[model samples]
Target: MNLRQLEILAAVVRTHSTIAAAQDLGMSQPAVSNSIKSAEASLGFLLFERVNNRLIPTPEAQVLLADAEHLFLMRDAVMQTASYLKAGRKGSIRVAATAELSESLMPQLISRFLQNHLGVDVSLETHRLDTVLNYVETGVSDIGFAMEPYPRPTLDQTPLATLDMVCAFSAKSELGRLQFVTPVDIDQMPMLKAGSGSRINKLIEEAFQKSRVAFNPSVDVRFMNVASYCVEQGVGVAIIDELTASCRPHTAMRTLPFRPRVQITLAAVSSNSRPQQRLVKSLVKYAREEISQRLRQVSKERSLKGT
Candidate 1:
């Protein structure tokens, strides 16, 4: 029988009279009686016996009532889950991010999100910027974090933060005394470079060109973390995004703002074909706040240090 019929059956069985059942269910007595008759017809059996102006449930009615109760419980659970999903408190969110962000930012963001949303499941994938965009474009990831100039025309991209590029150097180096590093300061010094064809490398080259200096590198690396590590080891000074350079407590590596302030724009990328999931949008908002707060904190600390 249908859920409404089963509900009427349950009400009648509980109240022991159609008149009482009708009052409990906000229906007329005849309406309750008709619903019981319909249920019984659908079940091909009598559900109740009328005697002494009272209703007594039959064996068949008891069995059906048990099943109906369980069905109602399951329906309640489904509704609760739907409410949770709608509120962005439950569901799975798949994210793909560039190596720099995945290592430096995603861990804290994902952890805080999980703490706030206990029922949500998060899957994180780390790759290069190109792969992160590909994952979002192909529907393999619900959201992606990568640096701009985002080349993917198939995905919607929102700029999240623009982090300045910083010159990273060993704490013991002579350049560490400077509050900022100008393109002229590092012109003659050996430098570690980002990948030759990377957007960051092009930006670095343009910065040097604007200063009327030649761009040169002692070592070439594909990742910002690698460049930072090389700077820490006194291999050479490198310009890398502030987020990647300042994420950890580094005693050996110190970062200074680069003069003329080369910047890397971080963006949230999502597929055009799929609607943005509630949890994914929540994550994007969380990430933006987290990064902004972090940058402000860093700026405050540097000001206090008189650097």
Candidate 2:
């Protein structure tokens, strides 16, 4: 029997009344009755015995119910999957990000994204800044998050925020007592800087040069979390973006605005050679809004603290 006949058969067997099954199936009682007759004729067997206006399933019909239940389950799954796909909720997004952002920003953003897109899965990879850009450029990753990635002809960049540089140090450090830390304040202090050649590092160098202070750093680290940890240990004062400082709020670490007001762009990088998938587009939009909201919260907190 066809699926329609099988549906009516199961409904009739379940409700034990054509009128009730018809109401459940949104069909007239006669139409349900005709469907049952057609199914019984096609099967060359009696599927139900009618007695006293009640339908009882035969032994053969009971066996078919078991298999029909499976079929109905599969049908429901297919329909739900189709609906999720059509609504841009079913898909996997691959992201490659620099270690700094992968640790600090992407986790919160991905958690928020997952809460909304229940059927979506995320794959996050942490790499160096250059490798992150390469992953997006070569299409190995759908998107990459980085701080001010260099302009590339093969990639698209979505600016999320322009974050100011902040000085991270132990709360007990003398520098923490100041309203703002400058290159001059940390000129001779042990300084923890990011790896050489990074965009933020370049900006930091420029700021120091403009201030005519030595840009020498006592240590070089690859990730902001590590730098924050060192600062918490009272190793040195590190200059990091506001995003990372805000995210890694170690109780022993305090951040002060670093002057001469060095700023860097936090951006989402993707391949420009091909169209982004709908899921990727939605994620980018969500990331933008989430970052903006977080920045506002940070600002409000800073304001309340008179910072």
Candidate 3:
């Protein structure tokens, strides 16, 4: 019914515990409970189900929580609009990114953008690919940086860069002697799986599935960084993203192209409904230019090596 109650409900959903939400809100547990109770009474339904003191938000609560988030963001937008009016060029751009972008590109792009647009504030939030897309869809972020193929009906996507996943090995490994890793070699070697859940692995899975060859994900890791670490420890070789392989902290490792398959893409997206803001436009332009240059440089290196 009120902003305070809506905020408390949203917090409870986010933290999944009343105690945690209370701590986060810097309020007493009793006060937080009272706010939720008041809100539920006003709505005439139970918003959350309690199981062992943990607040499991109901499906209806999920809708309300989403609405609450939108309302909160709308409030900020109003204030930002006022600031923009007063200062002419003062505002902020917020971006949500998945691993491919957050790994390094977003930070590098931000650094470059700030040099030219010093008056604009910038912030970034990293999340799963789906989560980042939703942030853009909801206008929670001015832009979303993610690895595609993403399922987005209401957003406009622009290709920022294309990424390739290649076999990486210690220089001492036999595979390191080969110019490229062939499909038959992958079948024999203990192929380091990037886990079935990774954004980049979706394409890899599709390719392997079509060929009727199993990926053989031995260790199911939750993070790409962990997979890289495992590869460094000689646990297994990794078919990691080009950006990941290029920046990986391993002097002894060499990345070779996967012979017949393996590729991913990085894309920048923004909601189609929201008209472009100056900061968002500037960021997209900067990212496109920088990423294109990097891609061209890599292509040239590959061409030279072909000779």
Candidate 4:
């Protein structure tokens, strides 16, 4: 029988009379009686019996009523779950990020997201830049954060932030005294470089070449954090993303704006094969807002410092 018929039956069982059930359900007595009769006819069983001018529930009626109550509960739960999903308040967000964003930004971003959406669960995976793109393309992750150029043809890209590259040097070094470091300033110095063929390394080399200076590195490393550590220990000056260079607290190193303004664009990648879910879209929006606020604050600080 239909939900309306089941509801009328339940109402009659609860109120013990067709007139009372109709009143409780805001329907006419004949309508309620007709619905109950229709339900009983569909099941080919008598749901109630008349004894001493009063209606008494049959054994079948009790069983059907119990099952009807369970159905109502299940319907309510389904509606609530749908509401949560529509509002982006409950779901799991799987994210993959490159080393730079994963180490420096994702932790804080995810923490803030968890705080705001307490019903949502987040899974964060860290990988190299290329692997992060793979995760997004293969649907292993819902979203990905990485540096450009975004090479995955199967993924849609959204630019998040563009960060200027900065040179990090030991606080005690003479070069640290300069407000900004020119490519020529570090030409002959022992340099700690990013891995060969990396995007950042190519940018650094290109900047030096544009200034008519030779590019040489005393040591080569696979990650920016390692290069930053080398700079902190006075191994040599290293040019790295602003996020990685700024992660250290009360550091023994100083960061100077590198000229002539090498920059990298950070972007969010999602699969093009499927429509984005509400939760994934909300996460990407929030991440973009946070990154924009951070970049604005950095710009303000730089403007004040005349750097």
Candidate 5:
């Protein structure tokens, strides 16, 4: 029988009377009696019998009562879980981010997101920028954080923030002696850069070209954090994004503003093929706010230092 009929059967069984069942269920006695009659017709059996003017459940009705109670319990649980998800308090999110974002901002971003949504479980992975895009496009990840992702029809990009490209070097180096660095300033120095075809590398190339300086890097790494680490070891000066530069591997690593102000947009990438879930949207919102707040703190610290 239908859920409404099962509900009426259970209520009538519990109360042992149509009037009492109707009162308990907020239904009329005639309506409850009619529902029982309909259920009996559908099942081709008598669910109740009149004995001494009392409604007594038959053996078949008794058998269904236990299962009906279990089904009701399951229904209630499903509804409660739905409520939790709708409120953005329950669910799991699988996230993939490039090495720079994962190393620099993702730890605090995840911590703050979990603090706000205590019931959400987050799985984070670090990949190269290209792999991050692939993970999202291939449905291997729910969300991706990348810098200046190229346009793709299969992927939807949401701009989170615009960050400057900075010059990172060892504090003991001569480049750190300058207030601000330019393409001409470190054109001939041992230079570290991202992979040759990357967006940052293209921007660095253009900047050096505009300044009439050579754009040769002694080391071309896949991740900005790796470049930042190399700069920490005094291997070479790195032209990397602001986020990686902020995550100094050692106190001796220093960052300076690169002249001409190369800027890149950090984007939240997701598959356009998959429908965005409420929990994923919540996580993105949290990421945006967390990044903005952290950047503000970084700016304040830099201002205090007069850099």
Candidate 6:
């Protein structure tokens, strides 16, 4: 019936006498007798038979003993698993990041995390901004990096970084010579859309609306990789995240600072129902440090240009 009762039963059978079982179990004879009596009352079966003042276990007692021992063993196994997780031992982490974050930041952050927790497996996916948000919302992934900032009421969003869209063109392009382009110039340069449904797109639209700058997109593409490929091929001028500018810097493409441009907010999103994350949260912490480093570079460059 109860664990103590089952243990008492086991001790009684092994010791072969109630008096001996009580001494071996560190309990009084009356205590062991009460346990066995309570257990039989609960299960409606006598677990032991008295033969010449010795306790002989019934058939049902043998079966109950097996189950009782198994219960304690399984409980120990569960406790060990919890200990492993708590100590940051073997397990897999599932993360989905925006294409922009994936390019420059995730590689180094993940590399460092992997070095320490070698036994922890990381499953990383590159996702579109919109896709990243949906994945986090639906619990498809444990953590998500996204710039497709829309309100997710159920999800807790932590804004990690804010980046500006920089112009990308062939090294030979006219605007690449200038350190930075003004809003008026941004209007004149051929626009290459970074696709629809992104916080960057909305910011661009709002910036243009405020300045009343009329510009037409020369090319439209999804996936930052593909858009950068278009820039590499000299398709047209494009505005992209700074990560795109940093990527493939020697690939016959040039980066130009754009003004009144879109701002991309990189956020880490996870569901409210998510378990108290240990490793994944540590990754997010590292990512924040990386963002700080990047922003410092951006600020330094901007200050030097002004001076």
C-alpha local distance difference test of each model: 0.84, 0.84, 0.76, 0.81, 0.84, 0.74
Q: How many residue pairs clash in each candidate?
A: 0, 0, 0, 0, 0, 0
What candidate 5 gets wrong by more than 4 Å, as runs, is 1-90
TM-score of each: 0.69, 0.70, 0.78, 0.68, 0.69, 0.64
Clashing pairs for predicted structure model 2, backbone only: none
Q: Model 5, 186: alpha-carbon shift in Å? A: 0.6
In model 4, the clashing pairs are none
Give the Å error, residue 63, model 4.
61
lDDT of 2 by residue, 91-187 (tens): 8778888877877788888988888888786878898888788778766677998888999999989988899889898889887578898888888
TM-score of 1: 0.69
> What RMSD does each model have against the real structure?
18.4, 17.2, 4.1, 18.4, 17.6, 17.2
lDDT of 4 by residue, 1-307 (tens): 8777878888887878999999999999999888878888889999999888667889998988776665664455466557658887657777898777777788778877777788887878888877677667666677898877446678898888888999888888788668899988887888888766877788888899899988888898877877888887879888998878766562788888999889988888999898998878888888888788777777787788777
Q: Lowest-lDDT window of 10 residues in candidate 4?
A: 72-81
Per-residue error for 77 in candidate 4, Å, reads 26
- Predicted structure 4, TM vs. truth: 0.68
Runs of candidate 3 with Cα error greater than 4 angstroms are 10-34, 46-89, 195-199, 209-212, 222-226, 303-307
Q: Which stretches of candidate 4 lie over 4 Å from their true place?
A: 1-89
Give the distance in Å from residue 41's predicted Cα in candidate 2 to where it truly belongs. Answer: 71
Give the local distance difference test score of model 4: 0.81
lDDT, residue 115, model 6: 78
Off by over 4 Å in 2: 1-89
